[model samples]
Target: MERTLHLRLTCGLLASAARLTPVPFLDDFLGDRARRLMVDKTLSAHGRRFPSKQVAPLYADPHGCLYGCLLSAVKLLLFPVKKVLTWLFALRYLTRDLSDAVLLGRALDGWLEAGRLADATDPPARLQEASLLRSAFDNAVAGTDMQLLQGLLMKALRGVSGLPKAAWHAVRRLRRGGAGADPTEGLSQADDDAMKRGTAKLGAALETPEARAFLEAFDARLAENVRILEARHASG
Candidate 1:
């Protein structure tokens, strides 16, 4: 569990940093990859061989897709305004990814618990459980006070102020090169180092008093809700 949390943090940082890439849509691609990586690692820890591709459809549905699209649209609308203020943009991006990481980690935990409560070989049962888990998770996320997460993330980013600024500069450098900049090649060692530092900072942030307090409240509610849902399903 501790290892999974750390993996989520690293992946969150990587995903957030991916947004700094100047190429259009590349950030979404890299962010999805980071999420898949988190899923893979979490499954591995549970001794489950289910690859992310196989597990994806279990949790994915029309509503989830719709929610994701809506989120993307919102971010698109805000990009221009947020882009002008590097610190605000960085904080928003970090909050987005890190909050996503927290939700995904909890969802993975619920999925694992679902698998444990049912026959591991029963695909249908597992699918049903995943569906229920997804619904619960989606509802919880939608109802969550996102501003609380943004505040926590702001506090975290402030702990290492220079890193986000350096990352912002790297993004600007890539943009200045315009069409000539290959997104893949645009990342220098300095950019990589900034990402590494950011990742470390994120991990450390998770251990802070503020983070722990938030997680305790959020995780308890999410976990209990999931458990009750699973229990009712099993009884039925």
Candidate 2:
């Protein structure tokens, strides 16, 4: 019965994604732009600095951006279907593809590393990349899969190595907190503390309304996703 429900949910998500009829040409254009932005800015510069080691990282950014663009386009196309389906499908695709997660992380890392933080001595070239990463994270957290949501959050943090040591410690603490608990049990005190610390660090560094909004949205979404997953398991 559990397996059957999983299959049904998965199929429902896939069907929704398949039925989406995005403006292919526009999506293609935006994807190309995102790719060009990554390559011309971060990847190309990084490649010059570390020619041999840069390919994988550079490729990941554009790949993730393209995937994100595709997902966004699909959401735009299927907007009339019900917002929940759009959120679920977008989350599923973002979490399912390892490459996509890597790319998304790299993109975020690049932005953070480029000194896009509010506390940076100097502002970076553009804020678009950081915005994209936040969007991806938000979408993933709002989905139905608790494990995937946590995994994606970890991946995103791993990519942002430039985040303060405090942030990294917070992530580790959160991981440890969630270690023994069933995914459906919700976040432990450690997890809550980790989130609070990370959010504080972020808020201090990037004192922007948008940034705070994203953090709040993420917290809400994560809690909601966990509740949904737990309810599903309980029902089974």
* Number of the top-ranking candidate, with TM-score as the measure: 1
TM-score of 2: 0.23
- For candidate 2, lDDT tens digit of each residue in 84-148? 55455654443343223233334434444554432322223123323344444545544534453
Error of 1 at 140 (Å): 1.3
In the range 65-182, model 1's lDDT, one tens digit per residue, is: 6687778867677765544563457657787877888667766766676554233556665555556666666666776777776676657556654565454544444344442232
Ten-residue stretch with the least lDDT total in model 2: 4-13
Winning model by lDDT: 1
**Shift in Å, residue 136, candidate 2:** 24
**Candidate 1 Cα outliers beyond 4 Å, as residue runs:** 1-6, 17-27, 57-90, 110-119, 159-196, 227-236
| Residue 157, candidate 2: C-alpha displacement in angstroms | 9.8
TM-score of each: 0.62, 0.23
Instruction: Please give the lDDT score at residue 39 for candidate 2.
Output: 36
Residue 68 lDDT (model 2):
69
RMSD of each: 6.6, 20.7
